[model samples]
Target chain A: MTDKDFTFTIDGASVTAQPGQTIMEAADAAGIYIPRLCDHEGLRHQGSCRVCTVKAAGRSVAACTQPAAPGLVVESETPHIQAMRKSLVEMLFHEGNHICPVCEASGNCELQAMAYRLGMVEPTKLPYLEPTRPVDASHPGIALDTNRCISCGRCIRASEDVDHKGVFGYCGRGIHRRITVNGEDLAHTDAAVSDHAISGGVCPVGCIIVKRVGFRLPIGARAFDRQIIGEAIEEKRR
Target chain B: MTAPRKARVATVSLAGCFGCHMALLDIDLRLVELLKHVEFDRSPLNDLKHFTQRCDIGIIEGGCCNEENVHVLQDFRRNCDVLIALGQCAITGGLPAMRNAIMHSDDPLRECLEEAYVLSPYVENATHVIPNDPALPLLLDKVYPCSAVVKIDHQIPGCAPSGDIIYETLVQLLAGKFEGFDPHIVHFD
Candidate 1:
């Protein structure tokens, strides 16, 4: 618990970090991937999805948001943590219409990759809730399918923070909450229709998709198809 | 005094493109090797219209979109010890189940019928009349995934699952090794 050395042991591996860095940041720097869905490196951490929950100092905290302290013992990838992450993924599936077969983001989706990483081949024990959310295809380049949205707020963060467009925002509350555009639909929003836009490629699932380019990358060639997400991230680190 | 044991497998396609069955055939020379361990019962592969006896495994390749599909799926559940939902159609209501997207609207079946038979540009003047014969199996309001209708013991997911995947899954099932299936063998698309 001493603040002298800027280092912490994560899953027994000592990872050094800066003072203000989060557990997730240190893990990323050391190539120790904490499985995450909502917390993308390019965007600010929403701490919405608790997929990156890890035991730190005997308390379960989201690694993406929890600051790393010296001598902090962080335990991730334990059977309990793995099970918790799996259940969270299951909860996401239950909440949304994530028919992975039909979803355009099946192969490349972070959620799907996470599920694969956790060895979730079958559907979760939770009852599937087939919510009939509207698919806004008014935009020429993008389609917003609310059914597959996991409410990670990545699009909300990317739109407002990164793109600085403020086109996307959260609507409703709890289970009824969803990502919404400021105007009539995506067509009327200030979305620039580029990869940099929040609604463009920031979506973890098949929620906000660029129209016509869904299957362009092909199945086997996609990011998660050839290598697991962690391997890809670690490769980037190397 | 002893009997030879072989796994009996029955397969059917409901509201699907039959691509899954094609994937099965894509096993090619391995089909001969597979036949050594398993035998086909009522399946398009065997050209059997109905099940003659109880089966060890039932491979369903489509979602239940009509009354006939329901009847057949129920029959599979009754006759088979293990029912495996194969492909996207069987597991998650593939392309055909896109019709269920209209579930939000009232009289979605009617809307779907009109859109398909009458309103679609593909339909011509003479052929535009909606088929409502008593002989035809009635279409369900929404296409249901196989798991929604019956207990699916194992699911092989894909638009049309790769032959290698099907072969691997079948081999695993045949070997009584249910757990630890290769993740690469089950891509969604």
Candidate 2:
């Protein structure tokens, strides 16, 4: 191992990482699953959703953005950190009209899976925003329903960075902030079903959906139903 | 030692589709076993309209969409020792809460009524008059989860939580062993 590769402890487990690698990247390499949303593999880390918040060096930080340091002690899976993550996930649920039962992304949704993993039975602590976001069903093969959008900007990043289409963008501020297409509707934009943003499993929720392919996987057979979120990452250790 | 008194259980459906009630029945033959521990007090299962006595447990299947639903839920809270919100409707207002998004308008209830009864081509209202009968229960400004109206001791979140979940919850609650549901079995859909 190079001199630049140093050791860090995540939840008391020793992990090795290169100098420039973020905590999330290093943790993944060590098969330590740091719960996160909006921080997809190969995509630029946004750290918008703080589901991966952890205590590093006695301070709370988003693991996805925080660079790993030698001898750094990171606390994850602790009650306080998990509680914070649960609250963040709950707030995301409250902020959006995420009707999981009717959502196309029901069982396959990362947000829903995270909620399940975090033991958030319901988002009862916060009032539902119930924002009347627009639904763009103009595209024959794709649909954009902003009601379920968590403002993670994954679609925005995937479209711009990967597809080179720049099909998605953001508008407004704070609670009013929402994802917007290039034009009036999704069809007006150059978004395609074949685009990496649509087909690449970028969206954590049902905001962006492949129309007609919904419910293709039966209830108990769907992604999260079969396995918990981050289980695959944790399985990497074996 | 005397045998423990069977828990007096009551159930009600307010602004829900009664699918939860159907799911409760979907427990199939296990219900016969469930009956061995709990006795129905004021439930549709036995067509009991009013509580004969204070109930040990109450299971509510929907959110409050109207004044009457709130009244019924409040009555349930008063008459039962423990209250459980039994479905997505009771927990998060579910499908009916879809109307809550339209509450941005000045008269959202009226707008919703007009769209449904007066404007929609699917319905044939001869005079295009919105229903305003005094006998009809007044719709609330917005649908509210059960916790917003009355204290909910516990919740089972699903469109209709599977029969197994309902059965397990009921059995555990009856045995006083319900810590919480296993996360794997607790699904939103």
* Candidate 2 lDDT by residue in tens digits, B72-173: 999999999989999999999998888887635666677788899998889888989998899999999899999898888888877888898898888888
lDDT for residue A144 in candidate 1, whole number 0-100: 85
Q: Which ten residues in a row have the lowest lDDT in candidate 2 chain B?
A: B101-110
Task: Quote model 2's TM-score.
Answer: 0.95
Candidate 1's DockQ is: 0.41
Model 1, stretches more than 4 Å misplaced? A1-5, A99-103, A123-125, A198-200, A234-238, B1-4, B125-129
Q: Pick the candidate with the highest TM-score.
A: 2
Q: Give the C-alpha interface root-mean-square deviation per candidate.
A: 2.7, 2.5
Per-residue lDDT tens digits for candidate 1, residues A57-96, read 9899999999999899999989999998988987886677
**List-wise, what DockQ does each model earn?**
0.41, 0.52
Native contacts kept, each candidate: 0.31, 0.45
Q: What is residue A216's positional error in candidate 1, in angstroms?
A: 2.5
